[model samples]
Target: MQIMDVLAKLGGESGFALFFMQGGWKNLVMIIIAFVLLYLGIVKKFEPLLLVGIAFGCLLTNLSYFLGHGENALYHPEIWANFLDPQNTAAYHSYGYIMKNAGLLDFFYIGVKAGIYPSLIFMGVGAMTDFGPLLARPKSLLLGAAAQLGVFVAFFGAVLLGFTGPQAASIGIIGGADGPTAIFLTTKLAPELLGPIAIAAYSYMALIPMIQPPIMKALTNDKMRVVKMEQAREVSKTEKIVFPMVVATFVILLLPSTAPLIGCLMLGNLFKECGVTERLSDTVQNALMNIVTIFLATSVGATMVADNFLKLDTIKIVVLGLIAFAISTVGGLLGGIVMYKTSGGEINPLIGSAGVSAVPMAARVSQDVGRKYNKNNYLLMHAMGPNVAGVIGSAIAAGFLLSVFG
Candidate 1:
């Protein structure tokens, strides 16, 4: 009778058995989705640097549900539930409680909760950015600013769809096509939606090549698409060194809430341009960036536990995110057409799509589309002007929303 009792306890505790008893089909579906993401990241090379980590994190979080209620599980939904409550005054205390009890995944998540990882990632991006294109063609800033039209449009769309003000703001930022910005805003306004928003942002960012080309072709005719921009005036090294400081000072003074993100971005740019901090710049651009990407991607993915992620809300977020992206692309293209007309055919409308802020990816798509029309027409440098400007534009827009809702 004792031996039978021992066998019964072992069977009850086994993860294989608990999988069926606990989350059931939802867990299985999430696990399969995780594997599909892994396959896309690894085999198909879809944003492998971040997606692989995200997929692994998703796998681990879903697997925790099968492990029975124990310390070995990487996530605790009950603990997470307390933090999700918007009005919970003791959210910080609950975070501390999770840190003391839960496993290492929860520990890494502190960076997300505290909004550290996004700022760090922005710093790294700044370290890698070259402001020469933007400085040479300051007019591109208008295109960048114009592209953000989608963000506001999506905000109203989300609000009309029955989301709260903060949640609507979070969803609208997906139009910016900036993953870190989306994560940063979502963490502040709607922490619970962080996973889906991050995934949607990055997924769209990776698909920029595929998504933007069709839109670019559809929006601009053959004549406008093939227009070759004049060579940008050479930007002096002193201008490059001074631009970050001036822009950072101006934007932050105008909107103090953007200091954390825009401040770090300019700091990294200063490290690069100052010519005295090559070591720091290199580290920020490469080593520090890689490390933070791992932590940020994994923490984001871990938030997508089956129970919370498999809801109607997640589906809505996904749909809304896609719509936001499409609208942002249209806004950028429209802005480009205006510039094309204003410049009297000197400006290629293709470069305008770079205003969506997918960095080099959006810029590259612009270049590719231009190449299809005329082989000698290179739009990379010109597109880059709006590409980097879009980064600053999105950050400023996020600050505006945060001031109002956060």
Candidate 2:
């Protein structure tokens, strides 16, 4: 009788019982998805810097539902739900209560909830960026603005599909092909959609190499793609130092909502260009950036619980996000074509696609495509103009949307 009792107790607490009996089939599906994402990040090297952490987080969070109850679990959905509403004081209190009771993932999620990680990431981006190409060819700013056509286009599409205005706006910003900007905007406008929206934004961003090329080819003939731009003029150190301040002042005065993202961006740029704060700039670019990225990616992934992520809404978000990215690429390509004709074929139509703000990746694509046609043609520097401009343009677009809906 004693042996039978001990055997029954062990069977009740077995791993098989814990996994199969605790959570439903959805947990198994989510685990499979997590493993697929891990394969993409690890074996395929698809944005491994963030995707690995994200996949691991997803795996841990999903497994938590079955692994144990109470404090042993990595995430607690009931506790997290209370913190989703930013405007509710009681929700904030509940968040505090849950944080004290829950595991460590809840603590790290504060960065996502309070909107600190995106700003820090922007600071790192600014520290690493060079605005010399943009300063040399200010006309590239127009191409940046043109790429934002997709944001509004997707906004209307989302609204037509029956999403609320704030939700539509949050969904549309994914077209900007900017992860941090998308996260920043979605957190403000449609916090409920944060998980899907963020995943869509980063996933499309990683697939830029595959997505933009086909669009570029379909839109332009070989002659246009091969068009070579004149060498950009040299910008002085004084101009570099002054550009960030002027841009920050002008943008903040025009759209105060952009202050958090744009202000941190300019501050980081100032640290880099001033030539006096090398230590600060270095830290912001490397150490602080990596630390924040780990926290941001992991927390964002944790938000993808089986119930939230497996809905039809997530499928819609994925489709809409793809549409947004493709449209933005088309917008940039068309803008490049116009510039090419205006410059009498001196501008490469390929460079305009860089305006979608995938940063050096989009610009590098332009270079690769241009080189395919004319080996001597180098569009990298020229593409950089619109590449950086897209960053500012997306932030401004986010600001406008925030003002309207937030």
Off by over 4 Å in 2: 1-15, 18-23, 66-71, 84-89, 93-95
lDDT of 2 by residue, 1-406 (tens): 9999999998976544566674556777888998998899899887888888788788877777653343466777667656654675676647567667677777877787677999999999999999999999999998898888889899999999889999999999998888989988887788778778987888888899999999999999978876778998999999999999999999999999999889999999999999999999999999999999999888877877776788888888898999999999899889989998988888888988899998888899989988989999888999999999999999999999999999
- Against the reference, the lDDT scores of all candidates come to 0.88, 0.86
Clashing pairs in 1: none
lDDT of 2 at 47: 80
Instruction: Name the Cα RMSD for model 1.
Output: 1.8
Best by TM-score: 1
**Clash number for every model?**
0, 0
TM-score of each: 0.96, 0.94
- Over 61-112, each residue of candidate 1 has an lDDT whose tens digit, in order, gives 8877543465567866666667666677776447676777676788888798
